[model samples]
Target: MTRLLGFPIADHRRVFIIALPMIISNIAAPLLGLVDTAIIGHLPDAIYLSAVAVGATVIGFIYFLAVFMRMSMTALVAQNFGADDMAAQRHNSINGLFLAALLGVLLILLTPAVLELSWWLMVPAPALQNLASDYISIRLWGAPAALMNLVILGVLLGRQQSRQAMWLVIATNAVNVIVDVWLIVILDWRVQGAAVASAAAEWSSCLLGLFWLRKSLALGWHHLRLNLKQLLVLLRLNGDIFVRSLTLQLCMASMTAYATRYGAIYVAVNAVLMQFLLLISLGLDGIAYAVEALVGQAKGQGRSDRVRHWCRLTLLWSCLFAVAYSLIFIAFGEHIIRLLTDIDSVIDTAGHYLPWLMVLPLIGHWSYYFDGVFIGLAQSRGMRNTMLFAALLGFLPLWWWGQRFENHGLWLALTGFLMMRGVAQAIWLKRHPQTLL
Candidate 1:
């Protein structure tokens, strides 16, 4: 009789169980970024750390561009699964892999041009700029493998295998840590080592993901066909995801650019805080992904009752997790930030922002939950439109105010950004309850 969110989680423990591995895996993904920052931040000069920040943040957006494919694949496959069409689900997985490969090539070609433009980005020191160049040039090689990993994880989620997804994350990170040690400490490769390590980890995961995806799809392998009808469905679904992703990535790129206005230290400090924010936000988002798969499939099966139940459990656990974790962070937030970097200035700056950072998760739970629900119901247009408005109306104006007010403006804008995005998306959800499944 105990409540999970608004539902009896006792009967739906499987959904939470399915999301657990993803939660841990999402946590690990951030650890990789943190490790890179820690290693580079501890180097003799601040330039080294700032260089990694510039380079990594730039490429992180690149990595996010592939997110649409991942989200789209998850929605499509989950719907197929709920329809009890194993063949269609398998086909969607394959479609995702092919699409990832195609996009990988496009990203690879865009690299040299991106680097040339990256040079124009407002990095204060030349040393940092060079480091950014080296890191970007080397890491761009992994675009294909990285994108493939996204698809693989999406398919596994569609099939309700979050444990496997988590295991893959663990295995991939192990490779990264080991390789990072060899390159950074052993060979003294510095910032470039971290970049290489990230790419290597993705390639390793892509290999394993291929193996797992193949086995999963082999069940319906015989029914695989690349017909026009399925292609249209995949393209349309993925197209919306792409637009949605572009808007999201633009918001990130804009954030970094806007921060760059305050000079490299602000950008650098923000870069670290953004990593922490991503780690915490996405870690909470693992629950949303759980809701996405469950609700999407439930919709397909016309199991409206189960969809509502899943949403209740997900929202409950996510808010509780956010509150509990944020409290622990409030208690030891600065202590934890200190461990990641020895730079006293950056540490102080990050801590100043840490309290406001805490509110982000709570205010954002609604949007994250709605995103999952909309994806599950394949309501990408609603998701896309709402985010577009948030970024353009909610964030940009707030950022403009931040610029006008000096330093305080950015912090207020960021907080406003989180609050507005969540509220705007909730409004959209109200108009489109079906997206809630």
Candidate 2:
């Protein structure tokens, strides 16, 4: 018991077993963006890169709004697993996939309207509107496959099948990169090619994921049938997470919208910088995924003590990793920027704001870790509330005030928002420990 409390070697092993594969997978996932950006960024014109950035942001906004499916699936499946309820786990996965399919179809249907509305909101320059529109038009074709992949991934993580989950992500991105190079570089299909590659990869991976889970699919179909009661429960959980994810994506989209006001150059620069930030968030998320699985399992077993232990050790390691990210960025961030784009102006502008990038990991790491903790505890409402407070109260006001500083102001507001979320959630968890049990 003493050894367990003192960061036992066994605990570290458990954490890494789950975290390492996730970390590798998460890292690979964002490289999709990096690869796209790098390929497009090298174009003779920066407009293509900016258009992809804006288009991707719009697609991400829609996709993330639907990502509540992923989050809820992970938590509930993890809890069910911990309680040794395999039937419930299978049921959840089946329900989640059905919902993912419906939602994806809805997104495809709404793409035209969404694209028009997005342009109105973003108000990009005339030249950019058509290019971005073309990119988005092609990308939405894969909406069904993309959302389905999210469910498969969430279920995989919930089942603690990290290695399998890693492969799914790797395969998806690998196909994306190969297609990206083939069409964009070899055939000069440009931004449209990037979109096609992404869409194709999604379809390919969805088929692969279904094939991989054929055995589970067979068992799940036999053991249970879907029903309204179970789905309602999932929907209620997904509802809160939906709002939370939507708000989060909106806040992120605002950064891109704001950048558009400054011109395609600024948009291009922000895209590159945002990619760096994405890498950091996803990398740290590897640790948070472990927290979600372990803490959630502990909660299912009614073992609050185990919940506390996993949270503590995971938090320690996540923060350490966050600090390491900051240091690496400090040392070599400019070089990374150079690798992403040959545009001299983009590189210089990105370097100016590089300090903000260095500090963001430290400020944002807590929120990422706490999100996992709350999700594991099935405290969806708390997650929603904290994010609202952070975005509405902390981020917007700081952003408003920081406008005096231009792009630096945008970074400042985002930093405050992240800090507010972490602090608020931490206090809540401290005050209401019952949630964990």
lDDT leader: 2
Off by over 4 Å in 1: 1-6, 32-54, 122-134, 181-197, 219-225, 253-256, 260-276, 334-355, 401-404, 435-437
lDDT of 1 by residue, 1-437 (tens): 88544566574577677777887878786677567567767778787677777787788777777688878888888888888887788777777777788888777888888887777655446766778888888788888888888888888887788888888888887888888888888888888888899789889889998888778767455654565677678888877877878877776666567777777877877777776676566567777888889888888898878787777777777788678667767787787778667898899888778877677667766677778888888888877887788878887888876787654577677667667777887787777776554
How high a TM-score does candidate 1 get?
0.85
> Each model's TM-score, in the order given?
0.85, 0.87
Extract clashing residue pairs from model 2.
none
* Per-model lDDT: 0.77, 0.87
Error of 1 at 93 (Å): 1.1
Q: Report the lDDT of model 1 for residue 55.
A: 83
Report residue 424 deviation for candidate 1 (angstroms): 2.5
